[model samples]
Target: MTTYSRRAPRTLLLALSAAAVASTLSAVPAATAATAVPTLTWEPCASTGGPTDQECAELPVPLDYRYPGGRQLTLAVSRLRSDRPEARRGTLLVIAGGPGSSGVQRLTQKAAALRKEMKGAYDIVSLDPRGVGGSTTASCGLDEGDRDLVTLRSWPAPDGGIADNLARSRRVADACARNGGAVLRSFTTANEVRDIDRFRQALGEEKLSAWGISYGTYVGAVYAQKFPRHTDRWVLDSSGDPDPSRVARGWLANMSAGADSRFPDFAAWAADPAREDAGLRLARRPEDVRAVVLGLAAELDRRPKASDRPGRPLTGNRLRQALQGALYSDSAFPQVARLIQQAQDPAATPVLTPDIAGALSDQVAAVTMGVVCNDVRWPAAPASSYARAVAADRVRYPLTAGMPVNVTPCAFWKGAPVEKPTRITGRGPSNILMVQSLRDPSTPYFGALRMREALGDRARLVTVEHGGHGVYLGNGNACGDREVTRFLTTGVRPGRDTYCAD
Candidate 1:
């Protein structure tokens, strides 16, 4: 659910920068000891797309922060310098979404739009976290079949059985432990915070302003907490609950309600008479779309249908997964509606979404699993505990069908967390701004409220009366983008929490 893609409205499918100079390391906790800053030599980016002015560099960070002088790994970094140097105040770091998302790539994709928005207020920069694109990498060496999105996401069997999930979870855990060495184990949120600080030092900047999205918001929050003095205007967009006790676990569990909250938007869109022209409408009334989808999924459970893909069939769980992905944005409604129409017809072959059609790259699977499993410890409860939770969740939230609470590699992950998850509190500078959609399928508004509560007076919330994943520059609501841009450019925030009407 924390995946990052440039698809419109920022799709939530599990898919799986820089500079340099020198600055003194600020005195902080010894646990995050200062390390030698590497000089960043920038060159034209290798990619031909994106802003032509974008430049690339690499920064060397310690593989393990406890021993900063020990083994080193390369972090790919990129930057788009402010065109109007006189207007530039400082660097703005773009923290990407996924534990596996490439920050360098994100900067590339959004550089043009961001440049226009900032109007030369800051030099925008981003970086690839360890095990991400163009950075030092590791692999769990998982089998091809196990890397499929549906399989990796822990979808229960057709009969609501988790026996297969348990086996797969253990298998993935074992494979990661066996093949992923210290490099993979080092991919925790704590380490990423350290790496970001190190990058700040390399940039010769005393402080960093950031726009952190989705999982990046977690990283940004942790960074702000761990190194409060080094933060400038911070923006957390599409954030999850910052409960240290239940970091990734709580985020995943909350998706059930998130899906339910966001589904009505898609339902209304699908039931619109406008969709009839494209042969994509599912029901005559908005209320009937849910039953139509549920009935089709239930029918698929009874008898799988042949899909456009040869070996892969359109099964019940796959349809459900597609629905979950499509719920993230209105742009995806037509594809899902068409697939539903195809499945209802016996002669037609349903086309699988790209996420369900193939396996993720081994590196992506490794990073996604590594960060979540290593960030915090999952409960070591008996399988029956999970079974009961899943059963209850299914009836309570049929859209997710218990997938949110199902067993994952984290349940069987080996080794304890190197450090406890960072508890985000209101102890830091009151410079944080959070923007969240009311009905975000991945990180729901309710979860964002929990983060807001934890941050207390240190942060103010901008609740958008919209439905989708990303908010600013995402749903294209003028009100939401205005508030965020105002804060970023003028260093002025709303007097209190505010709402932006859709």
Candidate 2:
């Protein structure tokens, strides 16, 4: 199953006319011809969601560019003005990772970290994409049963069959089509990039520096390509493959390799005597830790165990999904180990994290699923094709099993993409900086390499010798964070690609 860090499927290549897409979307449409830029009425945020310094505002933009002034939607925006006004160069936009991450929430969570790194060189700002928190939203009216992470993720059945996943995909897709209406459909990456340009104009800023994480990285890359002159300093943190043909599909598949790559760190940690005090050690040897986990999961497959959550039992796929999610960071190792410990005890009740215990509300799930499905078209792959993929993935990658390759809501999604997914190239100015971990479970380093390659000399990759997704100001990678901080402040990047050791 995918982590909070999101993914998409397939690698169907399409060579979009970048010149055409760029020329068309670089600014507000001609339909709003000579429409004076709307001024912001910044006020104290109603919620204490962010820091005391954080202020909030609302921005209105066209619901659809084709009819620029016909109907409008408001984006919730936040700002942490530079503490050092004299040092302030410009505004820095923070792009949160999820197809569903609320930018306002991300800004609040990272305010302190960003405060220190930025040193008041730029005002930090973020906004909720439409259909997200504090912004206008839409719902699929999905049943609660279909909202669980395991169920929503398209995990195959206990017997390595995809029939259940296929059924769920069709059900979820149909529900969205029937209930999501227009707001949900608005949740595409292209739309978000367009929204950003509007935000820049509203701020009255000539150019913007940015830090785009996870899926936001794609948005930033597109924005840079579409409006090269408008980018002052751009940072793509924990980027996924920008393979136009596959987009999200490629990201989902890359995660399988990421899991394989990062699990060793967890296994070694679990086997260490250091974990004994925490009652977390699963085995005395690294390899045995893997064996124990695999064996336990396989055992659970045959007979599910009751968990602390009523009516929701711990199953094989749940355990695998937990493992995949936990492997995102070493800090989660204890929780998963504790889960294994509880599962091993016949009389003990297994504990579940909020993510595993509570399902996302229908509106939340819709927004998350919306961007992935709307960004690109999926193939009409038959069940037999998924079965083969599931069977093969289960045998080859036990850590992720076949979940990463299995069918999802996108396969049964209703609408064709509004536009062809943008094809990233070496066409932008050399103003991009990408920082990535060596082993990111959601967006792997190898995938980041493809993003780096797509940018050609337009970008530089700071390979952090660590494991986890979203590297800069994340994972405590001092080297990587320092490089990014330096670039944002001075506009100087590595002359050639480089690496940062743990």
Candidate 3:
């Protein structure tokens, strides 16, 4: 889930007055008072073999909303205008997953599919949040070892010991405090929401429709809560619980259940007769696949296997982390199965997932840690509390190996949340629709139901009887995709909660 890269100005005259007033407001510093809706000078984006029509621009937003006039950070924004302008009704924002994902890249990746589906009904757009690709960035100056996917995820030792985890957590926290300045501190869900509003103003549109996936769902939900009047038709895919008290902490803890729910799908796939010919089948029965995977992990725990990467062996934790990554989609099952097969052979060298093989870039690590650590304060309880949690979690959910409940840098984070997390409520417009898989490895269906509950009467949920982290255009579920497309194109939602069979 933390793969990091997994991934306005309507009434011109009145708008001018609003900008003038905002500049002079006592809350804004005098040195940097400027129009809130700066005109965007869009130009053709540098060719990256993506959609030829895609255009890019830079939007300057305050690094700190509390001091809007003090400093500025530029957000990288991109758009693919409607081919049929006559059919266009509004702008649709595409929100990418991951607190560190590049919205600009996501736009490029999805532009063609979205364009084909929407059929020029709207000009699709997205913006890289601060500290992402093509945007202003900050670093925590972390050691390469600390930034590795396995280490950043806080996976425990072979015997389930967390002593190493505790030390790393404290060290990461101290490094962030010393090296990550206000820029890192500026990364939070609240700040991101504010940035969206600023982007809306710059777009010169009265409202925006959106398709927010994964963690983007949380960002979209907060935006709807803060600026209900500015939303037209909002779609949240692969949503998680919107419990403000827990926030990212709750999402992480819920992964244990999510992985359990989703693993069966992978197990079934691995056991299928079709995989036998490819030498990918792991077992004779669906139930047997679980034992095969678990047994392999335990064996690795006892004696790690050398991998394709020199000096970077495949340990139990690395395998577990790889499984977690693969569970996000059915398409990845073969890779995980192959890794499993290779691990079982003494002479075979397993190929590591790129993420598990090396360290994350400092900017990527900074934003991922910044948002989760800054959004809410993790419990600063004694290490024993975390040890107990990890121990219990391991027994309860072996697939995750207690990593979900393990202590992280958040517990020792130097910065406190600048503002309270936004509580998503039903008070907003009933223009929101959520699409979720029944068994999401990153965001379980049970957790998504919590988000459905929090939104109350204002939202409609289209549950897909499928297994994966994303729904809607993802997973190839015609039923689910139709429901979302109908809502976006026609603004017509199912009168009650609905289900889509796989």
Candidate 4:
């Protein structure tokens, strides 16, 4: 994930300038903090079907480090104690994907799988970042329609005009300024790293092990950089380019290339003879799948197919959304192809999953926007500048069209960044291990190579010659999974970059 450095001066002309000014005044460098241990109280985890061994706790962190004794927000945390105390090495924190994904929920979902693999080697734990899940949250107070995922993702107009994008960007940024409070401002990557250190202190662990995915990889890298001594085994999965200059902005822009690299895997699967047996085939030939999809998208662009939902239809945007969703996992390939097959036939109707259309609540959107916008400043000159980039992007990356490079709320965000973005270098410990899919849709291979370069000899990368995101355990690539597990459990890493062929 890319983010702008919060180091600029706040000026009325630019929203990010104010944010930068605020960050500068309130900034407390993570490494310079006084070494103070935090007291933690554990209670039974709260959820509809929470496990018997699961427990929850709240860690109080200052909203503004400058005013350490001022207002505090609670970070919702959960843990699954190590089953084998004799074998327990330390706490393993699961840093979740998506600036918006809930870490607590991820811990709950992956606890069993982790337990089976780690075999009581460490306590599995995670926390919902501030402004997510059960944690203290801030809202942009966006209207219901604008809060929808489709709108937030910046899907182009039916004719491919980006007028709506520019308007929405300004409107959303304004809402965040008026409604989002200090809690939202404090939700930067640097702050998350600081909070992780606080959690480490609270847990009484001399060193913390972690498995961070997607956006989490950048966070984990920052933690390892900021608190090198406190790190145990660190695993960064499906990482975006950790370019400090552009930060999350670069990650978003790179999606154009990432989608292009990973789309062929989807195309091949959609056209395979095996898909005919599943009744999910979109094309008789692999090469035809792209044209078929582009044609269908154009048709949808002209006239959307009605879905079961009253007002919602399967538009070009929805198709793009489904495609983006499907690209995340190989298991989702058939589902997207099926949607295409259904949309292609006049008699058949497409089904929309609740998980697909739901926009995060106002709080979730706020944090997602806050982290990306806060970490980096996006170009806000004019809609035409984005339009030019979008038009070029659409020609090169038809799978994603221009959504990834389009203007977002961050373009009109309220102030410059408040702190310098963490530049990941080889200066940290050599304990970090990265695993990536060569053709990952979200975090592409070329960008991962840059991360490999940035880490220098401080880290080693295991590249899985496969498609999709989250290589280890997500895709059925046993080689990558086993290698990562061995490294985390036994502290043995491949001496150099290695590839796992499918």
List the global CA lDDT of all models.
Answer: 0.87, 0.84, 0.87, 0.82
* Candidate 4: tens digits of C-alpha lDDT, residues 1-502: 1111212232321332123223434455534333334456889875666557899889887786665556878999999988887787777999998898899999887777788889878888999998889889999999877787778889788666899888998999999999897778888998888777767766756578899999999999988887777688999999888999888888888887887888889889888888788798888888898899889989999999998676788888888888887887899887788888889989998887554555568988899899999987777768788998888888888888898988899989998888889888999789889999989888888888888788888889999989999877789899999988998888899988898988
Question: How high is each candidate's TM-score?
Answer: 0.93, 0.93, 0.95, 0.92
- Clashing residue pairs in candidate 3 are 8-204, 8-205, 9-204
Pairs of residues clashing in candidate 2: 8-248, 8-249, 9-248, 9-249, 10-246, 10-249, 12-245
- Candidate number that wins on lDDT, 3 or 4: 3
How many clashes would you count in candidate 4?
25
Question: After superposition, which runs of candidate 2 have C-alpha atoms over 4 Å from their true positions?
Answer: 1-22, 25-34, 46-49
Better of 2 and 3 by TM-score: 3
* Cα lDDT of model 3 by residue, 336-363, tens digit: 8999999998888899986688789999
- Which candidate would rank higher by lDDT, 2 or 3? 3
By TM-score, is 3 or 4 better?
A: 3
Q: Give per-residue CA lDDT, model 1, range 110-184, as digits (tens).
A: 887788889988889999999999999999999998898888889888778999999999999999999999999
Per-residue lDDT of 289 in model 2:
89
- Weakest ten-residue segment in model 1 by summed lDDT: 12-21
